[model samples]
Target: MSENIALAGADLRAAMRICMQGKFPGVQLYAHDGLTRDGKPTAVAARAACKEEADGRKLQGPERIAALTACFNGKRPDLAQRSECRKEARAKGLDGADLRKAVDACAREARG
Candidate 1:
């Protein structure tokens, strides 16, 4: 995972606010779009104006994690890796000889 995940748009700012307060609404749209229509840019550009507002807040570990989770669309690559392993064991769609490589591929393709 990247050290910094850019939180873009006004909506994201609001989500961050809620997350900092130790709350993450499951039904809300944390990001305007997690992955764009075209997957060229892996990450969004940081909005400088919102940076000041975001930086001012101080949150505990869980709060910070919650905020980051929403900001990143709650994608867990680790979960993807585990699922890939199970699929590979079933020998269904996955035809890869190396289980480790197959799991890695599945994780890399996960959208966030």
Candidate 2:
């Protein structure tokens, strides 16, 4: 693990050096074109992602959201409740940004 971290650090340092020297294209660095793995245009991918996020957010009503919050925070003592929450999340397609936000919020609350 230490060796891997050292190698990654070295790679990042090399990249930073190249960027500092202005060897890398500034447009390529800032633009999303040709950056996608699936070959879809950036705008198409972004629109689809936004629509998916909206759908996921819309799927969870206030009650479902409260359940998710409780489950994520481990406030629900019963394992079954957690299981149910997972099932519901999957059923409602909680993924991507919405899921990330939920988990992050729950983590913050847990830390406090």
Candidate 3:
């Protein structure tokens, strides 16, 4: 049986908010799932900007991880590293709940 690792939804949301706030004041977030109208990630430039914001936050440990996951949720090809990081987390049996917590932490840190 495959072990289920949960990611923290709150953390993920927080991280995403932090990452997005830093870059965009009211930009909408979207999930790509490796598919788009052209079979590729859309809004590449916007996604790239968001990634830059996340990277600039300098989130460490789980917080960093959560930020990356949020980036993937947006399907930003510019954030190739984040996408890979998400894959690695899944491979290591990391859960979404845990990731969410990390994201939340990042958001709090960024806001403060």
Please report the candidate that would top lDDT against the real structure.
3
Report the lDDT of model 1 for residue 40.
23
- The number of the candidate with the highest TM-score is 1
Model 1: per-residue Cα lDDT over 1-112, one tens digit each: 6696677897787767577656554544333444333432223422322233345676457776565544434244345356656686458554546666666666666633
TM-score of each: 0.27, 0.22, 0.26
lDDT of 2 by residue, 1-112 (tens): 3554444675886666567658755534432452344433344444455446546766467755564545433422333344454555557788878765655555455446
The per-candidate count of clashes, in order, stands at: 0, 0, 20
lDDT of each: 0.51, 0.51, 0.61
Candidate 1: list runs displaced more than 4 Å.
1-56, 74-100, 104-112
Better of 2 and 3 by lDDT: 3
Q: What is the C-alpha lDDT profile of model 3 across 1-112, one tens digit per residue? A: 8997565786876777678877987654454342454555555544665578777997778887788667755665444544455565566677779765554554455446
Comparing 1 and 3 on TM-score, the stronger one: 1
Query: Which runs of model 3 end up more than 4 angstroms from their true locations?
Result: 1-39, 42-51, 76-112
Report how far residue 71 has shifted in candidate 1, in Å. Answer: 0.8
Candidate 1: what lDDT?
0.51
